[model samples]
Target: MSLNPSPLPDSDFTASGRRVLEVETRALQALHDRIGPDFAAACRLLLGCTGRVVCTGMGKSGHIATKIAATLASTGTPAFFLHPGEASHGDLGMVTDADVVLALSNSGESDEILTIVPALKRQGNPLVAMTGRPQSSLARLADVHLDVSVPAEACPLGLAPTSSTTASLALGDALAVALLEARGFTAEDFARSHPAGSLGRRLLLHIRDVMHTGEDVPVVAADVSTAAALLEMSRKRLGMTAVVDGDGKLCGVFTDGDLRRALDDEDTDLHATPISALMGRNPKTIGAEALAVEAAHLMEEHKISALVVVDDQRRVIGALNIHDLLRARVV
Candidate 1:
């Protein structure tokens, strides 16, 4: 029945991880220096692309190419991954004159990738290459060459793609982030792309989306007795009642805390006292268009659980408590 897990010893495994990280770190440092005019040119080409940025590679490079394409696509650049082997096998039709091809080959000599280069050129598609060798065939043929070379692989045998792959992936991120900023891709744009994510929900979920509206909103006329306001609060179960003017514009709020203070006044009668006299004036409020997180922050800052939602004309349109935000997963 025990659920606690035993700790594993870290001596040898930790050493290997440190070695791999150190190798990749050095590779990234070297890549930082190589980012010059060529990197900028690659960004410009991708930015100006009218069609998809088709990414192609072989073996390990294919995996990196897939990630790069995904990053580019998510960051506002239209792109996709195409296997070089498949390109010659009928996927070649995916390439078009309006598109740009971003080919990845650490050696610039992948037979599968090279086989499709001539056809791509014939189609008048621009080629952007990421390779370790500056004079690589792929590099020489590319309209823009991104040098993603590393001094050595994290692998002791120097045969496995390790540091090289890390450098390529990092360079891909640099291209994506640069393009995202250059295109003015905003948080709202990112939210649109990631609607199901928590960040997207936080940014896109407005107060109006989660607030209690219509009959669910707890409201009482300013002239109503404190007892009547309590009845409205109890009926709505929102912990507070919004006191409104004759025009249904919000004037103040009466909460359980306000009632506690009113109770301390021996001369006050809850049933006879006007709600306006006991209510807190200029209560914290939020517009229906505001983000839910803003309401959460306001609630935390003011030490209040509920917020009255208003329209452009400051008319009470809705109300919401912290629980509503929690239910909406905005908190």
Candidate 2:
């Protein structure tokens, strides 16, 4: 007998990988079709809940459950994760009568989770189970059962978790997003939860929060010489100065660039030429409460790098530059 070596190229290995991705993608699409009255009932149960949603699972499923719990918690739903192994120890104390338990298991036979079911029931907590087998032990005792079965594992040996875990994670995402939509949560609401993030600065940070106030604001009288405005701009290190009339209301803005154009005119005298002659009339202004992102947008639209925050009387209360927005992460 002659032994023949396999002749399949390396591309065949990648072909199998592509097949796996296609199968998993179809499994997620099927999950969308499988959503039914049970999904709606699950939402209703969680909607009226006065307590936290307790997410629990084992192995890879546990990782997905933890992320799901975090999404629910951050988006206005009170939730937390409980490792089944820890629950059998003293962690069961975290469960209460007001809490609802969400359990995840591929076989629905995880011993760690089974050991804590009795105690959970004794506390009057409702159980929501996610498993591939509807006839599984955990599913039998569950108040709501979400089916996340796949046709088969993507692994050629059919031993490792591939399609099933993907289905479970997708289902968890669907549930959390459903709750988010039902609550009518807004970007501002999300910004509150993520107050330390860039999104928060864009939505919650106002012009007053980052604008230079008091002595740092470059200010000069409208009648001040163009030469004097340059001195004020340099002293304040802002490259620009606000020109105010005798009544102390902002009338225009003068910058180093404007002074350059005036200096090119031989008739213009640096010491005698009025600041108003080189000032830009109708400068853009913003309110203190306006979002810093809005200020940035206004700056870009007007082709300027700074803004003057004014009150109802159009007096400069504060100032900000492009660098300030970048530092604040409002850009």
Candidate 3:
């Protein structure tokens, strides 16, 4: 058996980390001050797109392109990332005339991407180039150009794309957000695009969307035996069952915890008692149209998992528990 360790560094890792931060921060500031007509024109071009915005790049530019695509998709612009190498390899078929292509390149002359320009043009898709070298071939060939040039590289060798890539990422964020505002994109719209996200499911899902309805609801007659009500609750597996009166209107709810408290009564007659005798009157009722997340908050506030969904007449129409919220990703 053997254990080997590399020699310790002469410099502290913390100091190196701080240096990287300082470099990136400077890069961002440079990008912020560099915004001009090109940036605005880029947003305008994307805002005018009638179809999907396709992002493409090579190497490090690909990483930035992927992130930019996500931001655009979440912000209201329909977008996706395409790999330059893959596109040249036949994946280019995914692009169409209705789409706009956003190409990223630090040198503005990546060969893998340059190979696809002719195909993109033949398809009549407009090109918006993001590059540090505005005078390079890709930028010159573009219908719109965004300059993400930086003053210097953070890399000590002045070769690795450190500051330059940071600038590109920041510029991409600026462009996405600008287009988002121009399109009147909202948080709710963003949520709709990201339905599985916490904010999306919370704001977009309703009680009726997740509540157990139809035959899945657990209900008991107002006079049903404690044992019978408990059986219904157990059968439904929602931890609670609504107790309704002769009018078919909700009168109370019986929960597992409530049953536990009732069992503690020395005189409790479980076999002979009606559910109404141990039910919670005027139980919290949620409307079908109410947001499921709202129901979650109400449940948290009241310290209850399940609630009866009722109509204006208080007739139980549905039932939901915290488990439902968890399933819906709204918890």
Query: Highest TM-score among the candidates is held by which one?
Result: 1
Report the lDDT tens digits of candidate 1 across residue range 92-177.
99878889999999999899988999999999998999999989999998999999999899999999999999999999999999
- Whole-model Cα lDDT per candidate? 0.93, 0.88, 0.90
lDDT of 2 by residue, 129-230 (tens): 988888899988888998888887787888888999999989988888899899998889888989998887799998889999999999999888888889
Candidate 1 local lDDT, residue 78:
90
lDDT, residue 243, candidate 3 = 92
How does candidate 1 fare on TM-score? 0.92
Q: Which of candidates 2 and 3 is the stronger one according to TM-score?
A: 2
Spell out the clash pairs found in candidate 1: none
Worst 10 residues of 2 by lDDT: 1-10
Judge candidate 1 at residue 279 and give its lDDT.
97
The residue-by-residue lDDT of candidate 3 on 130-248, one tens digit each, is 99888999999899988888777888789889988888888888888898889888878888887777898889998989999988899999888999998899889999999999999
TM-score result, candidate 2: 0.90
Off by over 4 Å in 2: 1-17, 263-267
Alpha-carbon runs more than 4 Å astray in model 3: 1-4, 9-11, 70-75, 80-97, 111-125, 135-137, 185-210, 214-216, 223-228, 263-278, 289-291, 327-330
Once model 2 is optimally superposed onto the true structure by TM-score, how far is the C-alpha of residue 54 displaced, in angstroms? 0.6
